[model samples]
Target: MPAPTLRLPSGDTWTRAEYEALPDDLPVRVGVVYGELVVKPRPRPIQRRVARRLATRLEDAAPVGWQVDADVDVLLDDDEVEPVELAPDVVVYSSDHDPYERPISADLVTLVVEVVSPFSRRVRPSLYAEAGIRHYWRVETDQTAPAFAIYSYELDDATGLYVATGVHHDRIAVTLPFELDIELKGVREPRRRRRAGR
Candidate 1:
């Protein structure tokens, strides 16, 4: 059987309104960059687990005026016709956001996090840096040992790019976005219990 097709608005470029009008039944995740449509498969189970758990860890350590959320739409640039809109796996933004706003303005965001996958390895670090997001983290799945590795980056204003900060396998300890020291296992990944007393 063929998959059901949804009619998309026709034009050379897409605006925020058209992106919002996409059918609710679409199976893939979607976004826009410079009025160009970008589509991604819905996150797999492991991907969801990592992102949700990581968001929890960051939320707990968030400052009084900061708010952490997973999979929230962030408007990178409000260029009217060519707005760059993206939804980072995890985001840290101001606490003063409006509840009714679907796409939070990029100016309110300080940190953006993305999980690595075969199709997602090189998603959009440059875009985030271009929007002035100071902190960014990319989570990569490890087949063994610690289970995941998080690569943190800080944006360099002069170069308009990201500078690698630290690569964390067992734990993430950083102070840029906020003071955070979270254990990889049990927090971001499940902690294995010993079979018996060591």
Candidate 2:
């Protein structure tokens, strides 16, 4: 798809009204980062696969009061001019959260997962850490293999930033987020079998 031509608001800080006024049928996914507009084309196949399957796996393993979701907008910052609404690839959140909120509030969120895309190789998961979400995971392809890897982080309360927890490849077994021990390979694309030794 061609890049959508846009005449976005010009200023240091864009308000919520300006964001809501954007065309609802845009060809790209849209969000705000500290009042600045952030847009990206939809996820490619590998990105989608990892996010969806992981969400399902997490939800299945979640404790009673927690749940997992994919592609839900989180109200990270609600500042009048610099309000932020980021939609992470996958999220683990509280089940008792109110349904009436327009976008899921940041406080209600526990963990957020992002699949590294070429367009967002350096995208800031720090935004999530700043919102006080306890855990953040980043998915990226391994340099030495065909499978993906998970780099996990825990919030550092003293610095208001995220600290590396563990890098998971074959499996994800974490204590917080409820003693998870799921195979990371399941989220990756299935390997194809060669027929007749071709």
Candidate 3:
């Protein structure tokens, strides 16, 4: 039998309330982009591991009055009636801001980090850049090995795009928004469970 066809509202835009009403059981991650609904599959285990490690390192190195959080909603355009909201893998924002009370404004965000999954590789960077976020980091992993690469981007105000700042393979050391050094060797693929007998 063919899979049941699901229907969405007939429009190019949806309010935050409408997006929130989506079924919680949906397997994919959902968000609004340019007032349009966008969905992508959840991150695999390897992506999650890398996200966690990077978030931890950022949090530890963050100076007083700064906060590092993973997987939180950020309203990219506060002026738009139906704004674009992105939940980056990790976000660095002011400690005084309350994320739960309302979506964090892009202006308040100091840095955004995305662990590049197959689905997000192309779109996310442009979106963050368009939103005017100052700093962006893209983490890429090799499926065949534990190795990973970190690509840093800084928003170019004149062009409203991100320009590559640096690319680190084994380690990341930067002083932007804060000073920190992180080792990426620990992020690795998950081991498979063995069967009952060989």
Candidate 4:
């Protein structure tokens, strides 16, 4: 049998309030895209590690008056009745952007990064590009090998889509938003933790 659909007041669509009211026990990460709830399973350890490491590097290299953060909601469209929001793995915005804001407006965002999970590989980059974010990075990890592929993009104003600016395997050097030199080789596999009783 197929899973039951969630019933919203607007039938097929939901407002930000409705999305926020979802049960706290939900097992997956949730966001709203064109009023539809988009769900993806929680990130595995390696994914979290990659996001954390990259955010740290970006924060360390970010220019003064800029901020780099992870897993923060961004309001792409502010339709009062049916909004669109997404939480990229990493987001860079001006230091003056308030953290107290419910959903950070996309206009304040300079760059958004997503470490490609199986689910995000299909949807996120294009969505972010369409929202007119200036820069984006999609990080792809190898399943069997300890390596990662970093695809960098810059917004194409004419097409409202992202144009690939660079693709790096072991390292990345870019001068946009800020000068950044990221070492991808270090973000390969997550460190193993020892058992408590071992």
The candidate that wins on lDDT is: 4
User: Per-residue CA lDDT of candidate 1, range 12-52, in tens?
Assistant: 88876787676655677778889888887788677788999
lDDT of 3 at 123: 77
* Runs off by more than 4 Å, candidate 1: 1-5, 23-25, 142-147, 191-198
Q: Single out the weakest 10-residue window by summed lDDT for candidate 1.
A: 1-10
Ranking by TM-score: 1, 4, 2, 3
Residue 51 error, candidate 2, Å: 0.4
For model 4, what is the error of residue 34's alpha carbon versus the real structure, in angstroms, after optimal superposition? 0.7
lDDT of the structure predicted as candidate 2: 0.82
Q: After superposition, how far is residue 100 of candidate 1 from its true place, in Å?
A: 3.5
Model 4: weakest 10-residue lDDT segment is: 1-10
Q: Which lDDT tens digits does candidate 2 get at residues 1-93?
A: 576566667667678777756665677898888798887768878889889898999999898998778887788888868988878899888
- Poorest 10 consecutive residues of model 2 by lDDT? 140-149
- Model 3 TM-score, 2 decimals: 0.82
Quote the positional error of residue 67 for candidate 2 in Å: 2.2
Query: Model 3 segments beyond 4 Å from truth?
Result: 1-12, 20-27, 79-82, 144-147, 189-198
lDDT of 3 by residue, 1-198 (tens): 454333575466776666655664555677788677788678878778888888999999999988988888788865454768878999999878975655788878889998887657867888788778999998887566355788898988899998899999877899997899987776544547898985
For model 4, which pairs clash?
none
**Residue range 1-198, candidate 4, lDDT tens digits:** 454355565566888778766654554678888888888778878789899999999999999989989998888877856778888999999878888765788988999989888778887887788778999998887586455688999999999999999888978999997998887777765568999999
Q: In model 4, where do residues sit more than 4 Å from their true spots?
A: 1-10, 20-27, 144-147, 190-198
Clashes of 1: 0
